[model samples]
Target chain A: MAASAGPEIERLISLLAKLPGLGPRSARRAALTLLKKREQLLNPLAVAIAEARDRVRTCSVCGSLDTSDPCAICSDNTRDQSLICVVEEVGSIWAMERASAFRGRYHVLGGLLSALDGIGPERLRVEDLLRRAGNGEVREVILALPATVDGQTTAHYLAERLGPSGVSVTMLARGVPVGGDLDWLDDGTIAQALRARRPA
Target chain B: MAASAGPEIERLISLLAKLPGLGPRSARRAALTLLKKREQLLNPLAVAIAEARDRVRTCSVCGSLDTSDPCAICSDNTRDQSLICVVEEVGSIWAMERASAFRGRYHVLGGLLSALDGIGPERLRVEDLLRRAGNGEVREVILALPATVDGQTTAHYLAERLGPSGVSVTMLARGVPVGGDLDWLDDGTIAQALRARRPA
Candidate 1:
């Protein structure tokens, strides 16, 4: 068991440890850093977290987290509302936004269909997506999920469900990434690249 | 510039990015995770940080941070008052405490002597430590600083300063770690292990 650095600091460390990349040791270091720079980091972080807790809300239509009912992307008139990109989680939406190539709205599935983890379509926002697809406003549903087993399963299921509704379903193409060397490309990626070869 | 995920979420991400282990990308992920688990994580973390900020104080005697003035270790009567462990920062004190081997009080130096970094003895708690050593109650002062160049320089300076004051100053021995493999050991560690060899 980890020794407590008093109750308050210990609680802070434990919470920090629950973050995506941090563990117990790094959390303790982060806590000490916060304590050392109390006014600069700890106070500001506390205020930010409290503000986020009070203000953040999920988009009722798309399930993306934001300060408003509909997220910035969903509410923006400039974005292509006809194209909806489906992602595994809100983090994936953020990743897509970082690329700045997709100027379309998003649908967050909460998680991929993982049978081993007991996560089904019912546990995700699948019904909401199907409902959105049937509304006729959306012309294309881009499946931007991870190329994993569960992700592919969810994508295939979504394609099957949305096919009868007449909305065109597409997936991100898998190949050797841009700026990647052919020598370092995996066999699977090389095979994918060969299969999806385009006209010169 | 990084794109903002609303004002509150962006602020939280920026503040979290300043933590020891998390960078901007990981901070964004953490912010999203907090938003997703608002009731479970974000609110409690905010409360914990606020409580730590309001209640935590540095020990006047040892410079260790806690809810009390003398801190838990310093105020505990069961600990050996005659022995004091000197460390570079408060984080080092926490690391020492986690080992649960040292039952003595600690003195935080705030930082090591780094001429390149413009950190001198005046900037540290050197005078406080010297004064404590001169008070006659402390029989041994253990230097538990890092094995860096600055750490050794500070240790040498402290030994010189405390030598005239009659309290024996000792440094943590350098040798192979308890479970370390000789094949992966650095040359300096191997040399130290050879020099500090013991009969079985």
Candidate 2:
């Protein structure tokens, strides 16, 4: 980011530096690449970003991000409306979708209940979830939140709230991963795997 | 890369994966982060990129990139025009400027001549350097190209070309880099450092 390269490029570099994994040096390199391949990369990327900005929407029903109001998953009739997978954040939903194991819709909690961070049940989408659960369409709600203490506490709170609505609440199994080696597995994970063991 | 993220977000992730250090996974992460921080990062970055694209201009005299025709360094009157540092690419000019050691202007050759890549003298800005060197105002031309074989070959070719123009030709000194460890230094660099030793 030298004065010789000019202010506009410098501004672009500084802005790119704020991305998740990029720092100043890598941002400068990326800026140079973008500048060098203007027609091939810069213009198209700018258009893509603008288009995403103009079209991005949050699903009112499931609290997921998409270009539509209800989101693709919520609007799609092929997905099981009777089953809902609850997550701690939007990123977790994407991760779950990547696994391709669940055919159900999703509800994003936005965040876990952290008393130290002042994130209470009210801070999450708990009321909306409860309302959806009581609508008589959902038969089961899967708590696919993190395995952390806060995640478990939020899941328990959500279970208690949704139990009265006649919907069965379940959680992700805590155990060793599919390809996990016992030597590599942590103490708590090994213990959970043993405790949750059942007939295959 | 899940389908639930929509086509627009997927396109953004793929395009971002083409950047210098970003891969497909990191690109998705970057896109999600951008989506979350729409106003703070996404919108401003898009604007900066568009501005940079609309304003960037290659320096007419020295071949560096800037918003102005002659570039900031070339247009500045205080810097020594008689001494010119010739580098292989625009990135090198920024690298030199960051050191704050040189008080002269720079000339970007655009690329080094690579036989395997079919890059010849005509592909580079050699004629521009020759013209600038023979302009009577310039007294010295420094070839600050890389230490690789191709870079040295290009330097030799430039020296031969600039010889008839009456400007004295010099090159960057070959020695150990500052703060570089001796154990990690290559044999050639150690040999060069020993040969270029100076009295204390």
Candidate 3:
């Protein structure tokens, strides 16, 4: 529907519609909500977005996003520099950080090597990863990519490349999740759990 | 989890988290997506929001949001000037516009009169509506408010106030929605639909 609220509000609605989960209807609702709480919400949100646009930068070493070049994780000396967890995107880095389980450094590959899409190691940061691994500091290069075909292919490729460099290559464990019910578990997950069963 | 992406990105995420359907996790993902496509998405979005903030204003006569003083709908001379649809907010105006059914003007009440929340007629545009009705131009005032208790109370109050002025006060019909499933229909909707049933 053509917006009766004028072009500026319409522009805001269209822009908000580009967000991950927001559709045109919800974007219109969000625009109205922001307008209703202009002083409290809209102004602050606008400022924050503008500041993020001006300041946010990708880490040159790893591909994580931050205001700084190397990012806070890469610059911090306390983190385990010997362990480099490889991921496909910056969002995975944030997810890993949220878990608070891994205390190692990260390497964002930008994307997986998809043969169907013609993406290869040249398109990704595989050369940078090999160089980092060859440098005597890193001992283990963890492949924290997805379980999909492209992810597996990329993992295998990386393992072959990093093997000669003396860095151990490992993938995330595959099994049923901790709180998952066996009755609801898919066949693939059940089989993996059976194969990876540990002693009590 | 604490954000390692720095304060600016964190600020954007927190602000985005306050949107209607987004939570902390989705907001973080949205932020990363925005940052990843900064030139294409984030910059334009920030500009749009800033423009909306600077230009959008509440129409003095109807309480609807617009860049102009009277809003496009309010100033349009082609619409039915004798019919005024009273709604609770600007979002409802957009919904009504999407239907492409109404050809009249609108009066936004800002919110319904909620006694439990201590809201009364004074806090709304009830006085402006009364003034507009008494101007001897409006022949009908349609209450397009929600079906909640507060919505009904506000409609009743408006009807009582406008009864002596010789202006017709009406409400939107309550019935089952056009494409609603009978099995999923609530008791209230079923009763309303049955009461309003028409002979084929």
Candidate 4:
């Protein structure tokens, strides 16, 4: 590979190919682009990745990664501290934030409970979430996890654990999502939509 | 974005987003995977990229990027130095190597002459290729460029310029590519294939 593609470039391409969504061909293209835009993009990107790798740490409070111990959201006192949204991963919090609808704190579960994968409640930050819920400041614990079996199982497990606490437990609304057509939606989603139908 | 996604992680995602074939969503995914496998991937990738950026240099003889002044191919003594394959970019050399058929030296033109893009022969390594071709050791110079107007124009220009060098000028055979359907192939390709039909 080095003889053909040059050792330095080939090494860069191999490492880049390990990135999610980048196959060997796309990695080659990305490597070429990086090489072409060295000063403007590649240098900055390399520095950024190194900085992130070294400085980024899990928020002690919310389990989200950030430059600081407690993430920006966890540190922000302006948001509703009484509402805590439980999520499967940090990405879920970002997605919810992108909607700009949820103004509350978040608890990253790290992962969902999966029997096949042997990921139990202990694997997740379930204890941390329970401790946060029982702290008296949080009024609600919304399970904004996926509708999948693993997600629901984890949500149920958390709800059961938090039952002793006085905090309100809720699940994200389930139905056909925005931009979803009735015919195109899955059977389960359609059924849920039908069950949760509201006046137009 | 930093407020929602965490500053350091968000910065990493934004930088990754600028990579070729990666949008915001895929960048987020890549960032997540990197954060998840920090020791295994993120740290090493950052190091690899920085090393490549710093150590990689253009081969003065053939214009290919490598750790050495004259790239591996250019320095190789066993390869057919009498023949030179003119290519548009460094990627073409790698692609040719993948085919394992071309055992000649390579002359990277850097880019093709494009009037629309305001790129002329002087902008490319046309003079460099001419010099290499006229060095008296090269017996033939093969134009393995694209079939586009700009590519063909550049090839014709090179062939005409190399005419005085007394070296044989040839082109890569144009035809229906292997596994390419005749029905899916364009009109120009079909005509070219018919004009250059083989005995088989």
| CAPRI tier for the interface of model 4 | medium
**Per-residue CA lDDT of candidate 3, range A1-200, in tens?**
67655778888888888898888988888888898888889999989988888887888999788888889999999999999999999888888887899999999999999989999899999999999988999999999999889999999999998889988899999998889999998998899889999998
Candidate 1 wrong stretches, greater than 4 Å: none
The sequence of per-residue lDDT tens digits that candidate 2 reaches over residues B1-200 is: 55657888888888899998888778878998899899899999888987888899788989888988888898899999899999988888888988889999999999998998999999999988888899999999999999998999999999999989989999999987899999999999999989999997
Q: What is the fraction of true interface contacts found in candidate 4? A: 0.74
How much is B1 displaced in model 3, in angstroms? 3.4
> Positional deviation of A123 in candidate 1, in angstroms?
1.3
User: DockQ (C-alpha) of model 2?
Assistant: 0.66
Q: What share of the true interface contacts does candidate 3 keep?
A: 0.80
Question: Which sequence of candidate numbers ranks them by TM-score, best first?
Answer: 1, 3, 4, 2
B-chain TM-score for every candidate = 0.97, 0.95, 0.97, 0.94
Clashing pairs in 4: none
Candidate 3 vs 4: which has more lDDT? 3
- Give all TM-scores, in the order shown: 0.97, 0.91, 0.95, 0.94
* Model 2, docking class: medium
Compute the interface RMSD for each candidate structure: 1.4, 1.7, 1.3, 2.1
Question: Distance from true position, residue B2, model 3, in Å?
Answer: 2.8
lDDT of 2 by residue, A1-200 (tens): 45545678878888888887888888888998998898899899989998988998789998988988989899999999999999987878878988999999999988899988999888889999998888888999999989989989998899888878988999999998988999998999999999999999
Output the lDDT of residue A181, model 4: 83
